[model samples]
Target: MRGRVDEKLPMDGEACVQAMMNETTMTKLRAGKKKFKRSYRLQKDRETIVYSPTRHSALPECTKRLPAEQAYDVSNILEVFLSTLTSRSSRVDREKAVGPSNCFSISYKDQTPTLDLICTNPETAQTWVRGIQHLIQSRTGETIVNKKERWISEFFHAADKNQNERLDLKEATGLLKRMNVPISSSHIKERFQEVDQNGNGDLDLEEFGQLYRQLTFRQEVEDLFNRVSSPGGTMTMQDLHRFLTQEQKVQADAETCKRIINTYEQIGDVKANDCLSLQGFTLYLESKDGDIYNHAHDQEYQDMTQPLSHYFIASSHNTYLLEDQLRGPSSKEGYIRALQKGSRFLELDCWDGEGGEPVIYHGHTLTSKVLFKEVIEAINDYAFKASPYPVFLSLENHCSVEQQRTMSAHMRRILGSQICTDSDTPDPSVLPSPHSLRGKIIIKNKKLPPDVLEDEVSDEDEAAEIEDPEVQARMQAEKEKRRKELEKKKKKIKLAKELSDLVNVSQAKHFHSFQHSQEKDMACNMSSITENKAMDLVKRQAADFINHTKRQLVKIYPAGGRVDSSNMDPHVFWAAGCQIVAMNYQTPCDQMDLNLGKFRQNGGCGYVLKPEVLRKDYLKIDTSGKIPDKYRKNLTVRVISSFQLPSPSEKSTSSADPYVKVQICGIPADCAEQRTEWKKNSGFHAVWNVAMTFPLALPELAMLRFEVKDHDSMTASDMLGQFALPVDSIQQGYRHVHLLDKRGGDISPASLFVYISLQAP
Candidate 1:
């Protein structure tokens, strides 16, 4: 008989059970009232209400337990959005610097009469652009990124003194001076303009705003209109009138309202405690049957629906990113305005230090420094509305691998449930998910993978092959078709999956979900957190993470990764499974190390024995032609040079064999591997060098072979010649095939070749 609707739902399981009981009680009360049951009967606590705790406990009733399911709210999600917004300038400048020709960089938005808003999230940016596109499309049937800028925002007071078309030299100078901009008057004269109306002498507020919008939207509208309308003008006076009319305002407002309504409808549909994301909102907005508010008001509308705080700015900056941006003060404001206007997937060029500390400034010469913390703080305040954190972060690492890892690690820690750095999702219930990276943040790099690069590799290897006009045209057509198909499929799939994910099967338990972040983190005694206190919390925490940073790291560079030795692990495991083979062979490491010798004590392991590509590192061994890379250099054969003395007169062409008597320098004085006194100082001539000194690229190779005849038949294979040097033998050993050179030079892997023919057998 107990019943009620649970309001302050918790994230944990207990809170969910409580909510269920309350709902059931509410249902019963309605039934009872219809039957005309006495008020006293309905008031019976024993039958209608469940106590707060068990075991005869009535104390501490105010203490509430929230499961992890209800912890994060809009504020948290907004916090993330804003945190990502502050780096807009860096994002743009970075992109522009490395972007292709005609590619633009970061820009700002003029919102209020004086303020320039910054956008950090890229998806929200694209979404905003699409929204403007939609608006323009719906009204005039035109679409463009160019026109939206002109009609969008506020004004520069002094610059548009006359208000005719744009800011003129004198007025622009006054405006720039007023803004405390540090620039030459001559420069201002060249770039600034006079915003005058009716050929007037001075520009006013409206004129300023006019210039702002012109800078923002007029051109975009014109370009878009040109594409959609005939010469007669698609946006006729009638269309203009309709767009300006209150109905269109309502239509626009309705879109926003519809978004909220549809979102709530979807939320209501979700019986489980799953959280909403921008991706979800976009889908819900698309599915509305006319105006969602109008449709929902009739039958299914519920007053207890979730708010807009359910989602944060979408982060697409980390995706489809360019490599650089070159920006200045004027460019920054336009970028901010774009974010405020709701563009998603802002583009960026990023650099990560070896320590993973990422800096956002981009330019031919970096005159400014952008700390990651500063970016986080600005984004938190500007975009997320002090709540939801950004949903994605695309990054490029122009720095060291170690730095990339560090920057990546911090991103996971900061974004929390919104995004994650590791390639997997973290479970939510775990207080701080192990490596509790945020859920939605995504990062990317510019370097192509082997597979992609392979795809790009031209089989013909000549510009002429790709440049044939017919071939080029055909290829272009194919690319366009492929692109369109990819876009169509991606959208269709995303839309379908988004709608599917929105349906909440259970009204609780979302692993690392947004709705859950709230129920888990929301405190009953939160009123004490005043604005200043909240600001302080933001500044302190943001400062802690984004301030000046420097990091150093050491790691192993996979082949072709970079040209540095920053990655090295001195630790080596001499376990049983270790095997060895000759480098510079058609098939290296096939056979095995046949014995123990003084060479083992000299530290010979397959992993450490790199080709001579490394000798240039410290020894300054700049071999004539072969280039040195981190990975190849890490394994070059070095110590062998000490023992094998090459005859300078001998021509060491890879095709021609140059035999040199080389000592295996590491042999111990007592012949460590020699078993008895008879084998006191046994030694063998090393017939090869495993260095891949030859410059040939792939699958191509060369080899060096040795002919070893047993000096003493008794000592035979007991000698170390199978792997390294041999100890005391009557005739010692023959050094017939000394060193072989190929494209690179030397038989790297720097091991050996065996030849044995027993006397009687």
Candidate 2:
């Protein structure tokens, strides 16, 4: 069991002499020649200072060792000692010894000495200090000094908690997990190899517990023993021998260790290879901001690379976005909201909607019906006008390729022939380029190879081409026969690259990520979200104006696709304020000085917004003597919402409800009534055109809604439906409908019922 213990182990050899001389001798040692001249005068010097302490206080029994002189120069003293004593305290978690836990997070962390140590060279330092001490007291200068003997021995004796000798992997891992100190169990085995005294591969509890607290290397072990062994810091041969064998299976599996490491690392931004905290992973995903979706086709190996943008949100869900999106009917609305929040690029998918007009909505069923023009008009009429940035519309064919073509043709007609086809129709757009439209429209679809033309010449001859060597050589030299035609068969798909220059090329795909969970339960409302719904869209846009704009002026356009397929006019509302606009290009997290800890603890994602329309009716600029003829007109204001105007003090008093007045110039008194004609389209409360006095340039006035938003709308609530999903039924029969919140709330929820029947239908 033990190495051949030579009876004559101590040899007066060079190895013994070399071990004593170390940097400690040079650094901590001092020597000088006094003028003693053969040590004659030092005799008197020693007699004068003859006062001595008791034997117990003497150097040998001082019981408090000073740091040892360094072991003399060598490449590495520890490595040599380790070779002499191969005792390695390695008790790797053997999962075969254990079993798997029930749950796991996706990511993990690594918290080991290797990862944590920023020191230059640690192992070498521990060796020199311990090696010399062992030689003096323990009779052997081996640096290895483990005293553990039982794997089940208590590692933490100071604690009065549940006692277990040589803790198992689960217990150890759990301890580290709670401390947020992530590291694999395997690391402990590797570390033990450096400190094991005997060649044994394990350690007992005593050795392990001692090593955990008192095994730091500061002086030569034997020297410390000889100098002050009574006061501690010295290890006997038995202690050294015991420490090496005190190993236990703390984490019984590599996976378990890895998981613990991952959890800790994620919490502290530590790298556990792949383990990510559930919340951390969400934050990471949100940080991507759909960049994968925004990546261009020009990217290298586009097909193979999974973008950060297209993260698998759920097992049955994958969202392909060219920008801000999740591939659902809500994508368009999401994009618009992104813009409101300040995004540069917005993305949405376009499909044939009601009235055969291309409209934007994501689901297979129906949704808000709004014409393209309504969105554009709302943009124009808003308190804030839209920015020049383009909206990217990816038009797809839920219908057949032929139907797609028909829609394309119709698109060109309504868009003033700005949409054009390429290849077959060479010349693209004439007005500006469709591609130059603040954004782009891409027509995406799968294409089969075009069919090939029939062969013009036939080879009916059945003669074999082979011939004898001599005859073939002579015949081939003069064989200039008519070239045979090759049959080139290929599938063809007619693509419409029209108006591509004006808008953007609409790309296509035959792929769809998610499908209806219960197909049989879904009824057809295919036409509900179509361009025909633009009529309702117009109403929606007009309502937004009532909410945020002062324009009482009204106009009606057909409810259908006007441009990029979104319900611009009807579905969106505006907020009035000193809109926050950020410059300097800081990311969402950076600008906000977000608490990364809090962000991860709670679900967090990055966000940005692009200001489309910015209206400045609040601040008035006076251009004194600036272009005289261009100025000088009395201003007029219109009534938007329908409610009694609050008294100046009452309207201006409430914090929950905000009220303000804006002035409009260039309006006829006759048209003034047209602006205030009370109707369903008016907002909650508004005032019509009022004659003004004073330099009335900056007139003092007020406006407000008298009544609060009715909570009875579903039963009847206004603010209730603000963020709720739209109704699936747009038909003419009043039917009760219910919507549920899967998140489960103790407060008032979406259980309120509403009846919706298309008045027109």
Candidate 3:
């Protein structure tokens, strides 16, 4: 009777076994002990996944959908930690914290949550663990710890044929090639220099590891194109057209489409039935002839013809602290990151430190300190890696005479031949351009004269002032205090001159009358003033300051009251052609955003050429505060559509209803931002027909920032991405405006199709 009953039972268990045999594996599990299993079914040619649930007694079926935007990040879950190793019995309630013996939790980057998941059985737990591991391995190439373990041991053994434990340039290049990173020889040289901090020509295991980690890896061209190719490993003309128009959102005309096909199609010459093979597409993307990077200028174009004062230099203030001015850790990372971002001018507030060495920190504050030699070493290693321009070190000297000498020696030693030590050279009437000072480090500080000492006093002078006894005594005491303070200042000035002697390229001086500045010609009389003082000067002596900046260098730093490290708008001073409009680089505000946009020009070399009018010593324009915008041009932008729009926030599940904002940020009163209406339920593909117009003054110095945002009714819109382009570089007609990430790297496959037009007023 039991055999007959078993034979007549339903075959749902067999159906579940058959479903398990499929490619997809089980993932989600029910909270209770009903033995529920859920697995994801990957949709073909899309990122979407379907959740199928099955019970021990029922057949498998898809119960829910997992959209791409809200999909679980199984790949980021690097490891699974069991409760036994993670939980502490004394600290945590055993019942609530460690729910079950079979329960486990996953850990990922910077996110270690406390949780336990219940598994029905050992087989179920093993299946889940295997599935997660496979997912992680399939997505991320390798964990950093694993890469470190394998890279040094495996790569060093393969490359060090001589068993010297170090590799020269040639060996390093070959090893990189073997790793499938086809880095250029020139790029390899730059990378070698950046890694070889001690100036040694060879890289040991540690240096090689550093280079290996920083080496940017692009997908092998062939592999990349093949992944996107259609059936038979070839893409048709229509396929390429759809990719450009749909995926990239680039509206290339018919002729342009044909040109692209001819450029990339590898099967044969482009014809009516021509198709693109993987090799051809790879060639197009990798070739220097492509429109993408145009690597031809990467190593070739080093513009040094313009004067140093003629370019708007990217500058940073209090560059040692990583956080607020009041309390922050002073590290060399700030200098490294700033220079890597193409900053040419760096400020250092130097004070005496341990063992007679100078240190960098926020003066009179609780911020931690770092050795001045470390900052110089960091600068030397990274100054020209991103931009081949010269670096200007603006020194705020607060050290004693002996410590000042130590600071100078450390700079000379760490920087070596890069420091400009030609103090005895005849002063030129005009300043040298960045072209002439490439790979050089110039110091800028106040050089006080020996005559700044106070006048001598005698008993005869004390008898001259005859008044009431109380008044006379009070005045004498005040006079004595002033004389002592003056004497101390004079002594400090003498010490300041010792450090200032190293400044041959630029000299920091006080701004007096315009005539006083013109009296000196040898030193390129540069002035470093607070933004408040600069604004006051502009209010009282606008014409004189503008005329002076045209010939000499002027750096405007944030006010002393900015304890929070807030930055002032650089455009206010940039309008007067102030060469170095310095700002606190660590702070992220509207001013910093504008600074990024202004320096995005000239290949981001941290030197942008000033407009012709601002470069001239005299202009027939108004001396009043108002800008003459009538003489400027008009800009018009037509927003068409956008594709592959990412979610506003990383935690958002639903797609965003995207919109566009066009802005011209600068000193002109007419500068304002305009936006297009939000596309209704557009999701990842937004389509709109709208135009925005703005009046631009000083087009050569102005910045056009394009912001893409997601519309929300409950809260303010979230910014997706932004791209800042110089007004002069705005390409006319139909073109794609590539979006840039917060760090200012191009975000491929994310773009806006727009028609840009400019008309002279």
Candidate 4:
């Protein structure tokens, strides 16, 4: 049964408030069969949840204290759901260990373990779950003023020691240090005294908030406001309309400007007058309307009626490995994480196991194994969680006929009707569109001829697995000898009919030549090529490769020499119209960032419609830094300033000297980068009003990447944050580019202000 845990809970304001205020006793279930009774309560700030051992528990006195270490931030929570919504194996085990209806789990970010709690009853469980979910939803929908107030309140509470609800000079200094506010102690004291209205040495939460605003005031924002506002210090609706159309590049009229004023203008009289004050203008610039990414493309805005081959699919290679290919641990979590990140194509290296079952892992390597049945179950549960597009299982079968049959049975049993088999009988001349195959799972594996029996043998060459450094070095020393031995040892493996019949839409076949593929004209067949081989084909027969991809599917994966699981630049393959460029999802680099940015559009459904040039046969693509003048776009970007950038150094307590790097990644003709001068000791507010221009050959296929790094003379610079998006989706005019950490999590309130202008050649 599909889990309903992800569904939104009904709002129970009274019950939620009560649950947050009172302590609820529950049983904490941990891994390795450990359980303890604990009392959980949400902190008064509503930003943290703390728990302590119950009075009846046998835990030590030191652990029973309600310390800060025992709390978790509410912002870190990804989901709160009943335990019964987990995978089948986990559900059964949790049900048996703790009564089913009373158990719940909190899934957090950054690969943290889920917190499993068993309440005294179902009502109590529902209360906690609804309360947590309510808080998360409220935070997500909070207004600018509410968010800022909460942020200031959280810091004030953190600095207010001794539970006195007030902060003295020492406490205020500590808070400023924690906030990384680059200011002198004397200046801080002066501001503190000014905000201390009653002349008391200590300040309350309201007083502390005033002090924070004084220290973190944005002079850059004030200057921009003055440039746009009237002499009376207020912007009328006409003024806003002009600013939107001319400065932000947005097409806005009086009605639209009025709506924006109503949404972001905080003052009652200013909003009633259909005008925006300085504070209201600031909120408007920081809101989603002013974001760099075009919000219009935030949903399923693309034409989904195109054939599957006419779209780029987000795919993963070695989807089960959590680390390096040689000795990484293989778990179902890898599959879970990939699916959650909108990966529609998952690779499974299946081999025979100890018993009659099959397992998935890197073959002939030290990587740990996970049961194939469990992996299938996990896939069934998470296939459509992030997206409703059809998922593809790219199977690399090395199992014997018996184990292969077992694998097929497990897939059929766990996935049920979601698995598409040969009996579906898709048209052989053309593939189906993503819209037609929604909520389905398609298998991509080798299939036998109709007349062939299960015992019939077929020769299939497996890609060489990544080995240990020493083993790889030895093999390299005797490369020709090793090749000869491998060729001699290649044997014909029997194909099981049960497994073979599952392949229908995506039948794997050996790729011969581009001309040969065109002659065959079979749309259902696909081929997997290594990055090196694919690049070679691109260099030799660029037009032929493009024509071939327009008809059929091609997947390019990392070469086996990359034991570190590094990824190649996917833009090259994408420019050639290759639909699936598989990446090692476990690795993080610029290539992965590009991958994420490319698919981030179209509702992040893992299917991005290929550019018109790539989908049509008549249009020719040139990757040699030459393009027709008609398709060129003159793009100008001005890096205006940044706000609240995080310090890159963990060892140094001082601020950072941040610099911005702007890059255009696309066809060879459009690939270029420019860097701005670093702002010294100004992580909080760095201004660099520098402009750069690029002539992009193909704007539809180009991506704009903005990276902020801390400059250091003694060592390589460290990355603070980055944000990337397609050039086609960039909103023109002044916009805030919200930054993300290396793992792609949002670093809120940390963003760059940029001005963009795109003109046709």
Candidate 5:
């Protein structure tokens, strides 16, 4: 049977489907240094790509040992790209042997091994690449924006066991279970019968859709709509304007309401009458405009003319390791991921390698290595892809003079004009703004002494080695023994003049007392301190630390003891006006979520203008949770309902009892959390309708995190989905907060319905 494309599918999508359906024979590459010829084709349902060993293959025994057919779900694919773009060292030689143009890879979710394939020719490879890309784009669009209808369609197809375009009672019951809908079979049967308008024993796709809607109808939304609309069950422009102004706190007039009605109203008669039905109102409340994030801050609206020290820069620590610091694989893909995520500041731990080349890896560890030239090449390609702002290369140099020179040569050759050789501004007292340094790559490394004409060995790693006192003590105890055992190991490394000359605006400096830094007042010199030291400074001299950051940039990085690559709360350092709070980009946790959330503003340009209080020295910051009247805001959030939340346990047959924990993360005073009672067996449409209020001391520095968890009586609750965003960017109105999975992928059709209102405290 041939799969049929949807009538609504665009021309490109149709072509992609057509291309995918055609059987193609290609060589599949495996990590065990083995390859097998396979015949691959898209499934009839268009949901999976299945491959089988080609019968004409010479190795019949090897083909027999492999699975008869292997399939990959199209929905699970995260990305598809040319195999040459992969950063795995194991694949590098294989790709070269196979020819880069003839190789492509499909990367899937859940940490699945990437499916690498080599086509017979470059044209065939291009065809597969374009076809898969189009399908992915189509799937992503359906999941993010138009998921509700698409979700129904997917389940409808899933339940059609016989593929007769209809579902029997047994199939309908199974579908409800698969959807995680916990309801009595009697109720399901009643709904199914009602939707079976023709008195048939089975339900068609349209009938099943109606049945699903009836089963998962949202009463909370209907009640809210009834309260907001006019007496006639329809909202006119005046009614919508009133709702927007009063309930949503939006500054909207009649024309705005009319535009919204016209955009969201599905019924032509109601739209022509300049009124909104409940359906239109629901659509408008679930759109981008109704998202919790304020659309005004969606673009680059911040003042970018300020000095670089005046902005909160997104930064990454150890931007080479893909996993743990000890044994993680070092790949240029790490640099690509960080840069794509708007990390303007990146760290490179460069060490001397064989063949007069420099390598990047976690020093004094078992972590794998990648060529420094390859990392630089990746940075050059991806630096300005996400944001057109300046990128700061923080070099942790432990390389010999020759390798350092080679590294500098690679940067100059690959980066070329993008590498900022000198400061553009004449003023040496302040660094240039992000706008002024757009498309520029600034190096942050120790510079050679002015009097030194030749390469000189320096103890640059001494301070870095003793970042954690406990680790330093342990190392010191074993240092003498290790030195005796390995007499040839040296403590110092040579600093190359060429590399030092590349350090233009950002010169790495050792941090001393805040008073000493203030006296020196060099804006071009930046210092990086471990999280422990930064917290100590925040405790002892908060105001002075803020003052020091106003003049010079300070970066706070994870402590060396964090071999697991865990991150500290960045809000502490950010509150002290620290420009760069570097995080472990490889780790995904609440802290990283907060980091991404904070940088999600200002068009995600990797530079967010610091709040006025943090920038201005005169504004006194009370670290004790007390705030001035003007800075305080009363935030009220009413979590109305959640839709189609996934079960936390994949093996469990029971539906999820989901609850939302709303946390305000910022300063000590503003930090607070409130949670709703779990709705038992109601993950499909968990409604809390509970309102919680928080008095935010500093709204600008605050982030609101929404975590949805499945309640379990036997053990700890498992997280279902989570999302975090800046408090100030939250729009005041009825909004839908989309939930993201643990790895930050969109778990679309699963979202929280809420009404947000912020007022003067």
Candidate 6:
């Protein structure tokens, strides 16, 4: 039986039980003619689904209740994927399964039988859906965020000019224009042909999704064929070898290249010649068993129980801004984008808004603000989608008393089970691992000391009166401002009490000295240091940092002087075992590129475990210009070939003759930079057989960046594409080096063939 849950009913256990007993109507739940309908009520915590048989009124139901944590999903009967056990139902059976049936199925993670129940009416069906959804939300601490399905609907609606669900070429062009994506009409026609899989002239929403996923794939395959093929559209053996070794960085010898061509022909066309075709190229990329970023080989599963500091966490500074930090508009999309890219730590600068609620934005700047509640909701919804790891919310608070209270209340209520209000460990001697806090939000903020009582200002007033007339007036004004600020601060401190309760796991504090930090038993005392200060420490007390950060968490941020949102080179700080080396995420410069690439290992789950040396208590860092081992020797990278590099712009027909630059960033003394001569008039077949050697002392912390640039005589060279990877993770021998755009997305078909080898000096 189903009815509106009365608002007057008390939320307490006895009241809920009595109400359910009096209201619930027993009905048959038939599955292939077997009835298993049962009456159920939620436990006090609303996490247990307790059920009982209506016939057994004298005896109790099973003591073990169906825990809500076991449930994977809950929805209406029509929404779930149902498999009929018997043959097709008769018309009578079909009639029983309609809206009046109110039959729903709930699958549990445990091997328990799927719960099938029948409700008396539509209200019961609705109540079941809502109740199960609420139970799942509370149990998993998940809230609905920017769902991809909803996003697709919104995107399709915007693109469907005539209000129809289908998009024509003109509508598609308009959609591209709105996204600021430049595409030629010919390219659009070709894409439409490929995307309209059913041979339809226009694309529906699903077909459009297929088009979005393969936009780069189709573009690159055609561009690559154009670059390597002859006028007759066939690539010779030499052409294939050059393209593989020089452009795509496939690490194939001439014979290996021949075999690859043969393999492609075999898979695409058995009756083909010793040549490559567009069909073969497309097949290689689209195949499920293809070598394009294979998760099996690329991802390294490591132990996640190490101390929290023993990892390089993907983090962002001023995460709300997407462009220039000072003038850019802030939106919840920033959080969504960051989390989607597997950034685990996000900084939010909260200030009291016009309303009583708190808002997030760059303080004392022209940047726009996003609602604090919205940001938290977005974070809760998306934090674990990319990586099921804990997310650290670094709060830079500047809210007033009432607003701070509102923020705490909103966070506790909206975040609900996601907010970690207390430590999981009985005695947290060391920082908890990311695995333990999965799907949880840890607040990192300052624990302000007790508010000091205001002292009598009679002595200061008397002293100010004795000064010269102008000086006395200035002193009195300054005193009044200080008094007002102090009073406001006192109020803020008092209001911060509830918020501070949520910060049980991590506390923000000023860093004094390495020894001072070690003496404290605090598992996580996060200290944010300016880039300059961190650099100074690295120069003067590198060992101290290396020692302290092994057990404690340290966040190194950009200096205040960097108003343009320029990022600090994170590798230098990373070498010293810093957990969160934050940078201005708005800037997509070399620093951000390197950051994205280094964390690309470990499945891009946003946390890369530090090397064993960094986690040790006592270890030599080897800073004295002496090679420690073969792994710490000079790395020689040979730039062989690059393929399908993006032109200056999509509209421009002229192909760019590109060259490569290799930058090795790590410990300051180990840093090296080099560049290759431009390949003249090569278009997509740019080949620079240039080799450079980078002396590496600490290879574990090193990041190798390769940038492709178009040579120009009248103006500066434009960046075509770039790829970055940690030197330690690079596979030796011949390898295919996939290229990436500035935003760290894969530039498919655009790759480099490189030879990598290490030599000891």
Among the numbered candidates, top lDDT falls to 4
Maximum-TM-score candidate: 4
TM-score pick, better of 4 and 6: 4
Q: Would you estimate the TM-scores of all the predictions? A: 0.20, 0.18, 0.59, 0.91, 0.89, 0.61
Query: What's model 6's TM-score?
Result: 0.61
When sorted by lDDT, best at the front, the candidate numbers are: 4, 5, 6, 3, 1, 2
lDDT of 2 by residue, 1-761 (tens): 11121224343333433332322111110112111001001011011101112222212333444333221211111111111211132211111111211111010011101000010122322233233223333323211111111111212321213533343434443433322222356765454554445646543354444333222221222332343212333322232222212211021344543433343333553342333333332222122111111112112221211111111000000011212111212322233333332232222234455565554443222234333332322222211112322222223323333445555555544333223233322322211221143322222233322342221211111011212243334446444441121122112333333322323222221111113212311110011122233233323333232212121111111122221122222111111111111111111111111111111110112111101121223423221112222222332222122221111222222211212222121111111111113222222222232322211111111111111132222243232111121111011111111211111111111111111211110
Per residue, candidate 4 scores C-alpha lDDT tens digits across 316-356 of 98999889887778978788888988999999989899878
Model 4 poorest ten-residue lDDT run:
88-97
Comparing 3 and 6 on TM-score, the stronger one: 6
For model 5, residues 416-500, the per-residue Cα lDDT tens digits are 9888876465676778888898999999887776767555543434224423444445567676654543343234456778888
Arrange candidates by TM-score, highest first: which order?
A: 4, 5, 6, 3, 1, 2
Q: Model 6 scores what on Cα lDDT?
A: 0.64
User: Which residue window of length 10 is worst by lDDT in model 2?
Assistant: 110-119
lDDT of 3 by residue, 1-761 (tens): 00011223243433423332333433332222223345543322112234544443353334555234223333235354333222332121112223223444444321223223445443443344444544445434432234333434565655777868789999999877655444578998898999998887899888887787566432333344565667676777777776556544457656665776675554554344566665455434433223222223333344567667777899987777677776677877678667766689998888889988899887655689999987887787678877877899988777777788888788877787888766423445667877777788888776544444322211111111222343334467566654564344332333544565677678766655667887763437787666787887766776677677778888887775676778897877876668888777777655777787767556778887777666665574323355576657888887877755555675334466778988886555546899988976554457675888887765665677788888888888877777776676555544556676554544444567665767887
lDDT comparison, 1 vs 5, better candidate: 5
Instruction: Count steric clashes of candidate 3.
Output: 2
Global CA lDDT computed for model 3: 0.62
